[model samples]
Target: MRLPKTAHTSRPWLIHEIAGDFQVEDVWALATPGGPGDLPRLVSQFVSGDFPRGAPLIVRVLWATRWRLGALFGWDRPGAGLGSRVTSLRQRLPESVPPGPGPANLPFTPLYLLADEWAAELANGTVHTVMHVGWVPDGAGGHRGQMAVLVRPNGWFGAAYMAAIKPFRYAFVYPALLKRIERQWHAGTGGAPPLHT
Candidate 1:
């Protein structure tokens, strides 16, 4: 779906799904070019507020490590592994690991199970959706895009649950996180711009 900006707003963004002919139930058999159908399920962990708000950094680190490791072991398809990584990371975190950074000495029992399930299911194939949310200023301006991948597991409610979180993620979380990253990027390059906010 393409959402165009009106006179009131400067940024215009588009949300589109790139997929081939395939049943939602059989999405796992779909190929990479079809995009991931499961992403919404994984992203729901963040959008539903099931997780505390202060741990994006830790979540990000864990996600990266998990994907790298999964790929190294050949348990996941290189293309589909990213989404599985996010899902697996969320499953690994104990309800006890506070959102903000701290000692994360939690055991890896749950994570191992998650990894095992993903590996078993993926033995056939994995499906993934790479959602790209872009922000473009009013016409004749520079534009940028922030991309995210979603991996969905089976079930109707699970798929619906994942789809529901997409809009909120675009409206809030991703934008804020991108802004934070840009600020740090500027600060490291030379110094932060004088604060006006």
Candidate 2:
């Protein structure tokens, strides 16, 4: 993911400019592993009402993923349908649960797509990977938008682990993840010229 120089001075964000027809509808998915127990936990800690309050500003790769994809950018709102789930979880958590550290200062405008329960179970069972794929304009003024894919290990721990191990992850793990994402984009684009991030 490529970002402006200013991105470094601000909160971390990841952005990938993709190729596709801007007019067509697009989808973004954010998939994670673990059972239903993890869903509520992940939502409560990482994807919840307190997110925006803790991590306020964000710059996203201009797209229409509004509610679903906005959380990665730290633009999620408690009223954005996540309220129901959070409310259910709050019933479980005590009134004084500590807040997580919020979003990081990494600089990629995130793109994501959610998977179905069966697909998530399959991916979690063997690979334990969470991926992001977005359908966006091809930037060539075409009707077909490009689908971008980014694969990372399943669980919120990937984010925490990456942070704790940034010096190593950036030099080693991040490059590997980027290569995989680029490869998927190439494959999805079907021999079309690759979009430079």
Candidate 3:
């Protein structure tokens, strides 16, 4: 479910320190319900997603369109990503840790993996993005996952690109995503064992 911005802002997440200048694009209540110790399970299932696969058709099309445009415009060139177009957010960490790669199909770099929270980042020519996941009480003694997306647009072009895609994200991408998470949670498997344990 979509949540108020305060749902994410109210938490004292380390990301508040690292990405203070970034915009809070969206906050969501994931459908994965679990115990307090299940954050790793949630994160594993999330990052393991074969995105645009289980996603809605429109979302798949959008992903295809985006990659095509990116290729055509050199927006996704190796030099146009992290460490070149934008410095790595790792530099903003309070204490540095060795960077870990995300899933094979995705481009995110895992920033940190704490007991109850995890953060990962991805960058392209258009924007730098942070995806934060938190294990929070579900108000009934159970726990669930929460997500917040923070983005820093590069310039006029970046801002325009974000604005153009806002509707599609809200309309298709996010809903399909949360539902997919829900399915994974109820399926009694997290694809792999916990990571940060």
Would you estimate the TM-scores of all the predictions?
A: 0.27, 0.24, 0.91
lDDT of 1 by residue, 117-138 (tens): 1111121022323222222232
Task: Name the candidate that leads on lDDT.
Answer: 3
Alpha carbon deviation, residue 56, candidate 3 (Å): 2.4
Model 1, residue 21: C-alpha shift (Å): 5.8
The pairs that clash in candidate 1 are 35-128, 36-128, 36-129, 38-151, 38-152, 39-150, 39-151, 39-152, 40-162
Number of clashing pairs per prediction, in order: 9, 21, 0
Q: Model 3, range 1-197, lDDT digits (tens) per residue?
A: 89999999998878888889999888889888789999878877866667668667887788888888888998888897789888878898866554443654677778888877888887888888888888999999999999888889879988998888888887887777777778778995543111110
Ranking by TM-score: 3, 1, 2
Sort by lDDT, best first: what order?
A: 3, 1, 2
Candidate 3: list runs displaced more than 4 Å.
Answer: 96-101, 190-197
Choose the strongest candidate by TM-score: 3
Q: Give Cα-based local distance difference scores for all models.
A: 0.29, 0.26, 0.78
The total number of steric clashes, by the backbone 3 Å criterion, in model 3 comes to 0
lDDT of 1: 0.29
Candidate 2 ranges with C-alpha deviation above 4 Å: 4-131, 142-162, 184-197
